[model samples]
Structure formats: structure tokens, C-alpha cells
Target: MLASWQMREGFLRSGRMATRRGVWVVALALGLAAGASAGEEFEGKLTFEVVSKQAGAQPVAMDYTVKKGLVRMDTKVAGMSNYTIIDPAHKKMSMVMPAQKMVMEMAIGSVEPPAPATAPEIVKTDKTERVTFNVVDATTLTLVKEGEAAGAGAKTYEGQQYAVKVGDRNSEQWIAKDLTLLAGFVETFKAMAQGPNAAWMKRVEWPGFPYRMVTKDAEGNVLSEMTLVAIDTKSPDDTLFTVPDDYKKMTMPQAPPAMPKE
Candidate 1:
């Protein structure tokens, strides 16, 4: 069992990006509490069978594990490794490579504070009534409202989409017909590439598995597709969020030493 403060700290540290990707594992553990509460506590195991394909080559299979809060991805691909850590609340995330025995930590925050506009865009399309906007640029679109359409059974956003679901406090969500992309989806990738909240105007692509992405290679070979398998609302064990006592603690890379004082 873990202490409450420790759990709170873990929650606070996990940022929007990490939580968006793996929150389902925890949500599965939490069960019904996930529905009634904004952010119900949770913890559980996740097994990911990832397949990647390039032009003419056959798809490659990779297995991954999500235990507690740690993720271990094993593959022979370059620039990727065997271990990673994600914290959603605080916008802090880290990755580790067992072969290199190295760790990288990054602090994540919004690239730009949400615009000062009080109201989101409400549009009444021929099919339905909804609210939507590109918060940072056209890349990050947030759907603030939705109503039924006459003939359409469901809606779908086809391009550059990430995970879909209602978000908790500390984050906003962009919704399309059948998907939800967390605010941190774009924010975290931007922060990792540039710097904390670094600003750029060009449209950047959304990464990882989201509802909108189609798994295809240049030659039109079908890779693997991700689908929403299930959802759980029950509250999970409070201890699921904590770092383990037996696991080794690794340090992130050190920044260059400050220049000697003049």
C-alpha cells in the first residue's frame, strides 16, 4: 500500500500526454469510480502488441508492458529503447534505454495559454450542432459542444487525431464525431522537440495512436490499427499511482555545467 500524499504527488506529476496514452490501464482498474469522479485513482497492467511497416517490408511486431506507471518497449529500432516513464498531472515524463543505461527527463507545459476567448465556436452544420476551434493552430482542434444529427449515426475526424475521451480538470479536450484528443497530445511532443512551451506557427503532425490516424505505409501496405477495446468506471487501488520500493531509481541526464563566474 502507498501513502495518500505519495499518490497525490504521483497524480500531480503525471501530465496530460502520458495520462492520455495509458490512462486506460488505470481506468480499467478504477472501474465505476472513473465515471462518477473527475479523476478516479487507478492502477493495472497493459499489454501492447505494436506492429510497424515501411514500404515493401513485412510488418514488424513488438511487445510492450505497462506495469503500475512504468512502460517498457522492446524493439531493435533506432532511437527507441526498452523503458519509459510517464506522469500525466504535472506534465513531467521520462524515458530509459536499458542498452544505453541512460535516462531522459522532460518537463511539459502548454505551448501557449488558451486564448482569452470566453466562448468556444458553436457551428450548426447541415448534419448537427457542435462547437469547435483550433486552439493553438489548425493542428489542435477542440470540440466544446455537440448535439444529435438527423441521419448520421456517428461522427469521425479523419486527419491528425489522437485519443478521444472527456478530460478531467487541468486539461481541455478536442472532440470529433467518434474521437477525443487531449490538449497535451500536441503540447507534449512540441515541448520535447523544442523546449518548455516553445512557440511555433507551422502545423505539426499528431503522434501515437489516436482515432483519426490510419495505419498505412507509403506503398499502401496496411500496418496495424488501434481501436477502443473497453472502458471502466470503477475506482482503482489508491496505491497504483506510486513508484515501487524495490525498483531501482534512475537519474535523468544532467545539463551542462554553468559557465564559471567571471
Candidate 2:
């Protein structure tokens, strides 16, 4: 059985912005509204689907809601639902289990980016494609380069957000163009650089959210993947950003002690 931290580390470092139950949302919304209402936070809803051939895991839906730097994610276990909230500004993360009515929280530390200029380079291609899904019409877009992988079709604002439209049934987002939303990413990437994922992480250089990514193992077997399915831009209820009043706070369990190094 995989330990909790093992599972969570991937979700966190993989640049997850939010998630949910039965319809997982994976969003990274960085924004500056163009003709959009002022004081508008980058609210977004998305569904994430994961397929793994090696693990033989059933395709499960994870939903996400994101606004500003706050994220609300939902998941389930044994038919019971669990929710997690990540607040980058406060540097905290909490897990709430509805069935148990319990809430567990942990304090997180922030990381500094290597350079403000270390952002992704973008260039337009002649290729064009239409992307559509729930609530979003058939929006045509042009492919842009991020690095080796070239599959982003988005309309750009001078120095604001990128409204990406990619393929049918996939969600779109307004990825932040500034350094504000990169705090969590900075921490995750810093960890990746020091961890085993260093080489792989450095090679890709994905600037913002990845709407759809398919990862395969060395033997060419599909390891796992996460893709966007749905999206919305309306601000979610404020309650979604906090622990429910019905849930009680619970102390997190401590890890087992490490063995002596000898």
C-alpha cells in the first residue's frame, strides 16, 4: 500500500491547482481580466481524469475549484468524501473528511524563485485548432511553443492571462502572467530539483498549468495521465474556500520515528 505522503507528493508537485470528488478539477488560474469585470479573481472549475495502465487504477473523476491563490479539491475513499484546501498566501493546507466530520491542517513554508526572468518563452505557430467544452463555446486558437512539447492553442493578452482553448471536451484557463501565483510552484520545483525528479522537471520547463499531459514509462507503457474535461469562470461560493462548520478539527498523526543511522 502506498503511504499518504507518497500519493500526496505527486499531486502537489505535479502542479495541481485544485481538485474535487467524482469530477476532479486541475486548474492553475493566473489572471488579469481584459474587458472582464474589475476586482474579478481568476475563478475556475475543472475536471481531472487519471488513467494508469501499470497501477490498473480505475478512471476516477477529481474536481477542482480555484480563485486567486486559494484552491479547493475533492476526493473520495471507501465511499466517504474528503476535501482539501490549499492557501498559498497563508502557507497552509487542510484536509476535511465529511464522514468523520474531521479537519486536519498543516503549516507550509514558502520558497523563493531562482529568478523573475526564469519564465516560459512563447512563440506562435501557423497551426490553428478549435477547443470547446461545457459552458465554453467553440473557441479557435493557435498553437504556441513552450518547449519540446507543442500543444497550446491560446489567445493572449498584452501582459495578462492566456485564454487557452485546446481540443474538444477539455477545459480552458487564464494562467497568470506574473510572479504572484508562482509561489507554490516555486516550492514544488525547488523540491523537484533536489529530488529524483530533477532531470525530468528541468527538461520540460512547463511555465504554467498543463491542461492535458500523458506520461509514459521507459518501456513505452502508459504510467499515468491527467486531462481537463470541464471548466467554469464564475466565482464559487465563499464557503467552498473554507472548512465546513459541521466539521470538527482533528490532530494529524505523527510519522513513525526514523531508525538510527548507525
Best by TM-score: 2
lDDT of 2 by residue, 1-262 (tens): 4765664554343222221110111111111111012433445555556566655467656666666667777654345456777665665567666655556665543321133222333333233333223223342222232332333343332222222222111112223223232223322221222112222233443455444444444444555655555545456788798887876564432211111110
**What lDDT score belongs to each candidate, Candidate 1 first?**
0.30, 0.41
- CA RMSD of each candidate after superposition: 15.6, 12.0
Q: Over 4 Å off in model 2, which ranges?
A: 1-41, 76-80, 111-131, 134-209, 253-262
> Where's the lowest-lDDT run of ten residues in candidate 2?
22-31
Count of backbone clashes for each model? 23, 16
Model 1 regions more than 4 Å off: 1-49, 53-85, 88-91, 94-212, 254-262
lDDT of 1 by residue, 26-59 (tens): 2222222222244322223222223444455433
Candidate 2: residue 176 lDDT (0-100): 25
